[model samples]
Structures are given as C-alpha cells and as structure tokens.
Target: MSFYHTPKALSAFDAKFEAQKIAFGPISFQVAHCLLKFEVLATIDQAGEQGLSIAQLAQTNVLNEYALGVLLDMGLSMGLVWLNGDAYVLDKTGYFLLHDDMAAINLNFVQDVCYQGLFQLDKALVAGKPSGLAVFGDWQTIYPALKDLPAEAKASWFAFDHYYSDHAFPQILPLVFAHSPKHLVDIGGNTGKWALSCCEFNPEVEVTLMDFPGQLAVAKDNATKHGFAERIHTFATDLLDESRPFVEGADTYWMSQFLDCFSQEQILSILQRTAQAMTPNSQLFIVETFWDRQPSAASAYCVNATSLYFTAMANGNSRMYHSKDLIKLLHQAGLYVDEDTDNLGLGHTLLRCKRKP
Candidate 1:
C-alpha cells in the first residue's frame, strides 16, 4: 500500500544490467558457491596485491585456464572480481564472501536449507501449505522436523535464527525488566537461550520456558547445565492446540520472534488463549522484525524474503509481518499496545501490551 522511494535511480543502461542480473540470479549464486567451494576465490584473495592471471590460477589449482577465465568473467560482472590487465583480483564483495559472518550465515542457510526446496514456492503459495518441505521430510511444518534435519541443515537453521535474535537480548533485557516483573514466561523458548539470559540478568526472576516437547528437552538440558534448572521451569505443549491451556503464574508473557510463525488466524487464536491466562497486572511483550518498519530498503528486502522461507520451508502459513497488520491482529485479540519501541537489534521492534480496557 505504500510506495518506497530509493535515493538512487538506475540509468537505462544500468536498468538493463539489473534485469540481466535478476534473470541469471540462480546461475550467479551457484557460480559464487563454486568459486568458494573450489577455493578459486580464496586463492585470488591470497594472491593479494599482485592478483592472479588465469595461467597462474590454472597452474596452481590444476583447473583449465579457459574454463577458469569464463567463470572469472562472470564474477567480473557480479562484482566479485575485477580484471587488472590480464589478471583477476578479489573485490570487496569477494572479500566479504570469505570473511563476513552475515554473508556466511546467509549463504549456508540458503544453500544448505533452502536452495532445492525453493522450487516449490509457487505450489506452496497456491496450496497454502509447505509443499517444498517435502524436500527435507514429510512433516506438518519445519518446527517438528527440526529435530530430524541433517546436522548441517539444522546447524544452518539454528544459526540463522540465533544470529538475529541473540544480539537483541542485551538491549531488550533492560526494557523487559523495567516493569520489575518477578515471573516471566518465555514462549517458544528454543534451547532456553532467552530463559538462561533472563535468569542471569535478575536474581529474583523465575522463568517458565514454554515450547514443544522435543524443544523443551533441549531447553531443559541447557537450563540445567547453566545451573538455572530450579528457577527455569519447562512447560511442554502445543501452542496451536486450544484445549491445552498455558500455565497461569506469570507477571510477564514473552513471545520473541514467535507469533510470526503462524497465520493471522492462528496468531489471533494464540493471542486469545494468551489473553485468558493474563491477570489485569500482567504484561505481554512481542518482538518481531516487521518488514515495513525496517530502516533501509536492504533490511526490508531481507525481512520480506524471510516470508518466502515461511512459505516454502518453515510453515507455508506465516510470514515476517507488517507492523500495521500485527497491530490490527493485536486489537482484534483484545490486547492493546501500551508501548512500542523500535530499532532493538539488527531490525526488530518490541511491543509491550496490556489487556484492552
């Protein structure tokens, strides 16, 4: 509904180049992967100031000079390499490919967990289910399937999840504790990371970690290992099951990057159940990366693309929501936003809510 304006407009020539980039995105990605896998890019990086000609590269790596030259030509257009005379040198993008944390995380996530499965995006969109999930295993959603994924795939999935959520914890802890709540519920407390954090931050606070049974076992182990076992209670239940009520003794209910895993109807249903458990004094906190609220178009692009992961791999029913859409759902579920704070971490917002008057 909103038109976002960008600072730079592509000239007609640049626009055509952009179109070509989009047309060959998959090929470009695979080339990048091959470059990394074969260490051709790394070798170039090591060559440093002098760079490497195709002759030198071929002789060193035991690759065909012409074939390496063709790939490097592609890299030239991709900004991954530059032609210095007859030699090729690594560019800024090429350097990041080898050393950047964010780049590595994203590349692994896409290649390991998402690449092959994304072919079913159109089918998932039309059927309204994660058809692409079959590539991993036949399951209702990726949550239940996480325990069974290949080790590398699981590593990528958790790494992607943690990279975004973990950094926000330090800044968010102060905000959540400002109300001085004695007991908190960590909804979707995957691996008890946040629960452990809460227990460490406050001596008086007790946390109930709520999650599916498989995840609860991991959380419990993490809590026990960290010496927070007694203070961190585990509640294992399916949040999607309406008959199973949430445990009631909580001054604050926290759902961090959780609600966006379900559809609007499911989110409303979960909120309605959460509402029933809240006392008048209880507060609900929601943390999410709303695409519309991002500071930059690039950040917005990342957030929006995550919706595709939900469509093709995660659940097929949920997405990275717009702030307006989430607020509307909150209003419908009889919760009103009492405080709205943004820019929590990379790109997240915290919504502190109370039962509607």
Candidate 2:
C-alpha cells in the first residue's frame, strides 16, 4: 500500500509550514533598533538602584530619551522590558545585553556598523562594487567621523578588535611560540590588539605592528595601555604599495584577518613580499575563517551572509579556502605549509607555513 498522509495530518503540517514562513520574514529596523537602544538604557539602569524616568532618560547625555521612547515601546512588546504602569524597567534580556564585562558586549558593533552598511546590500550586489566606498568615498572616511565620538562609541569598534584577537590567539599562538621566535611582524595590525595578546602569551616575543597612520596612533595607545609599549612597536605602511617595509630577519609573520581584504592577485603579491622578508626557517601564521570539510547549514548561512556584507561594505570577500588552496598560494610565494589547524572557535582556521629551506 502507498504511504499517504491522512487529511488531518497534512493540514497540520501545512499550517506549521505557513507559520514558519511568516515568522522568518526580514527583521524590521524598528525591532532591531529596540534591542540596540535597550543596551544603552540598561547600562544606565544598572548604575543606580532606581532606573531613570522617561523624561530623565530623554535628556541624558548618552542618548535622547524622547527619541528612545519609540524604541522602548517596541522593547516592551519584545519582552525586553517590563512596564509597571508608567515606569519602565529592564528585563532579563536587557541586563544580559548591557553586561559590559562579557566579551559578547561587542554585539553593538554589528548593529551600528554592519547593519547600516548592509542596508544597501541589494544595490551593492547589482553594481558589483562596495556601497560604502561609493557612498562615503573611502574606508578612512568612517574612522574620522567616529574618531571624536564618545568613549562608548569608540569602545564599540575596539570591542570588535578584542573579539577578533580573543578568538584567534589561543589556537595559533601556542604552535607559533613553540618555535621560540624572537621577533614577529603583524601586517595591517589594527590597534595592536592581536600583538598585545601575542606578547601577553609569550613574554619573550617582541612585535612590530604595521598599519595606516591613524590606526598606528590607536595601536600605539593600546600597546601602552596594555603595558606592551616597549615590546610592541608601531609603523605606518601600506601593504599594497610597492614601498612596503618588511622587517628582515623576523622569525614569524602574522596576517590575521588581512588577506580576505584584498583580491587574489593582491594577496599573492603580499605573500610573495612577506616570503622575501623571511629567513629560510621563518614561519607565517594566517588566522581566518574557511568552510569545514562538511559544513553545517548554519555555518554555510553565516559564511554567505558575511561574504556578502564584506563585499558590499569594503569591496572585500571571504571564502572558505581549503588547505590545498592555501598550500598552492604559499607555493607560488615560495613557501610551504608546515602545519594546519581548523575549527579554532569563532569560525576561524590557522595555517602555519615556513619559508622554503
């Protein structure tokens, strides 16, 4: 006999499918802004026993309460806040979102930067160029606009720097330091976050961070704050320019989250230049995300979304390049892969290679 569903079972399945379809529609900005605005308010709420009134919240320096009430109403609907008559209070989600001590506090970076950048995703894909560059002229424009902002705003961006380092260092550093390298170079190192982490992990390692002038200034300050001023040095350089400096005799080179920012040809040129700077025994460690041997649905979805966002905002693209692809690139640059590690948490992978001896 044929296996056919009963009419009642088929109706129930169809109903569930329709419900899911409705639930999965695009997330509205009204809803998104509610979550973000709640974070700022929740932070204020925790500072004192009594939460600020709506009028007080509106006039607060961190945020304008009148503009924020629109969001607060939405938050109430989302169960992120509780309304005791006219008094508004934070709920469980609000407290967790406002917790600054957690590494995940960096979620605001996504809401503030990525969300706005991705708003023009459809136009970006059709034009086949970065909307951010086209809209704002260059990557540097965004920095100056944000440079003078409050510390909270600055911290949002810095949190991303911290997040990247926290996820990448643990897996890659142990293997690199095992060789007892004396000096290392971090190309395009932003704010020296990764370099500081490296120095913290291996006290013997001295680091040279190379980046743009503005980024170097920030990195210098960060290095000082982290007590790595003497050990970590900053220099302004363009990795893409022919005049780029490669500190000769360095034992290791780190290119974390750098390669994906360029085209294939550009990456090849960068790798070649880096190889020329390395001694025969020198090593290179690359920390990035790539597809798993068998990727799950969630992983694939994340990769696709990130690739699209990067392309739109920065004219950059991320791919899950296999070990063979990396080896081929290294070989073209006259280097060889010595070790490889995958699934380094936070969707990162590490490739350790050495200059051809």
Candidate 3:
C-alpha cells in the first residue's frame, strides 16, 4: 500500500488532529525539522525514560520555553516525539529522523536545496519550466546550472543524487560486466563513481563516460585519480540536443539513475538516437527508481515525492515513472526490455533491453 492511506474511519480526536496537521503542514514541517536540526531531539533523547520537561529542554538549548513547547507538541503529533507524563521524550520516529542515513540525506536535500525554491512549483506547472530554480540561479533547468549552485546547495544536490545511485552500483556492476562486454558506455555518468567501480570490478572492460561537460570534468578527474584514466574515456555532449551525436560501437549502453531527468518526449528522443547507434548485439541497460517497482512503502514515498523536486527545481517536465510507462517509451524508441530485474540494491529496477528486431 502507498504511504498515504485513506481513513476508513476516525474518532473525533483523530479527525481533529488530522485536520489541523493538514492545515498547518508547512509550518509544522519547519518546526519539526528545526527541532531535530537544533539538537532539541537529542536533548530530549539524552534525558531517557524520565524525559525532559519543556522548561528543561529550553534551558539546555538556550531556546525560549514557548517556542520549544509548541515545536515539541507538534513533534508529538508528527510521531517525532512522545509525552512521558508531562515531560517530552524522543520517539522511535524521532530517533530515525535524527540518525537514519536516508532520512538525514532527504532532510538536508529538502532544507538546503528544495525548501525555499519550492514556493514557485505552481508557476512551474503552468509554465512547463522550473520557475522555482530561479531562487538558485537563472538557467533553463537545474542540470546545466548544477556546477554553479552555491556550495551548500551543490553539496546537498549531489548527496541526494549519489545516495540513491551509489547503493545500486555494487549490485549492478557485476550484472553489467557479466557479459564481459569490452566497451560499456555509462550515460550520464556523474562524477565517474560507477565508472571507477567498473574499472575495479573488471580490468578489461573499457568505459566511455557520457554526460554534459560540467559533470564530465569531475568524472574525468575522478577516473584519473582512481587510476582508471587509461581505460576510461569521456564524451561531452548535451543529450537533450537532438542534433548532438552519440558515439557508437559500445556493446553495452548503460544509463543509471539518468532517464528520470527528462520528459517522456526527451526520453523517447534519447532512446531513439541510442537505438540508432546500437548494433544488433548491443544491450541497453537502464537503471531507474520506478515508483511502482519500489520494494517498500518508504521507497515508493521517496520516489513519488521526488517527482515534485523535479517539478519545482530540477526540471519542470520530468518525474519518477511507473515501469509500464517507461516500457512504453522503450517500445516507442524501438527497443524492448529483455529482462527487468527489481530489488537490485535498495529499490532500483534494472532493465536489460535491446534494439527491437
């Protein structure tokens, strides 16, 4: 089931809580986030079973009692905290919200990269462009402007990007190299992390890192520093430009966590061009977080919610896709999924496809 469950029934207290939660969602999020961010949660957790009263926590953190009380009360409703008698204590959800790797990364991404910019999502929807991205810089989209984002924003963006993609690399590397394909083209190979892993995984496999010039610079340096320079090659081109050509002859073309960055029409164009480059024997591998194929409710939540990030900040036209919808794009591109492997390294689905006969 999706994380959003419709209430078949609710008591008056529950209904009232739900209504208030929805009504004050934005400020509630800010309050709960600040509580965790400012170490208020840790303070309460350190107090253990006895818990810490609002005045005690406020004194410890040098925060006002009124502010702390309201935030803590909101956290209680948000499941980030619980009341022990009259005192406040960190709840199980709060512990995870503080310490869980995924939660922390998502939180940082939201606060640093998305929070202020999301104000213009409604405008973005109307214009079919990322209007919210204006908060960061002026550019048609975020990808080309990624290199220019403020330091903290850039860090948060890549951290969010790599967190989801990195976990899948180790699992995907073996599968990609199983065929002993000599030349594997890593489409949108950000920072060459996957290429570095590939070089380490199979020495004989040569890699062509394909992406925009901004990303390729970092990728090339990473490959060089990692001693994969001899085997690693770079292809700098904006795949969005249909006139821009892609190199051919690689037996395998790999797109990892890349396709979701474009609209369906853009995806079709990329795949169509890619299909033309493929020999009858070439295998096209697409690795993406398809919302419908996610392994858990939490993963599905992240995937679906990320669509909004794309909507407001990354690119206004694209989003996380359902597997069936992506498969339709594949067919439109004259390719077919030969194998669809799900549950590969933290909810990623790997589609092993080929040029249609």
Which of 1 and 2 is ahead in TM-score? 1
TM-score of each: 0.95, 0.69, 0.94
Winner by lDDT: 1
**Could you tell me how far off, in angstroms, the CA of residue 344 lies in candidate 1 after the best superposition?**
1.5
Estimate, for each residue in 159-270, the C-alpha lDDT of model 3 and write its tens digit: 9988888889889877877767889998888778888888898878999988888889898888889888999999999888989989897899999888999999999999
Clash count per candidate: 0, 2, 0
Off by over 4 Å in 3: 1-19
Better of 1 and 3 by lDDT: 1
Top TM-score: which candidate number?
A: 1
How many clashing pairs in candidate 3? Answer: 0
TM-score, predicted candidate 1 vs. hidden true structure: 0.95
lDDT of 3 at 189: 84
Clashes of 1: 0
The C-alpha lDDT values of all candidates are 0.89, 0.67, 0.88
In the range 62-86, model 2's lDDT, one tens digit per residue, is 5576656766776665555677656
Better of 2 and 3 by TM-score: 3
lDDT of 1 by residue, 95-166 (tens): 998888777888889888898889999999998998889998889899999979999899999999999988
Worst 10 residues of 3 by lDDT: 1-10
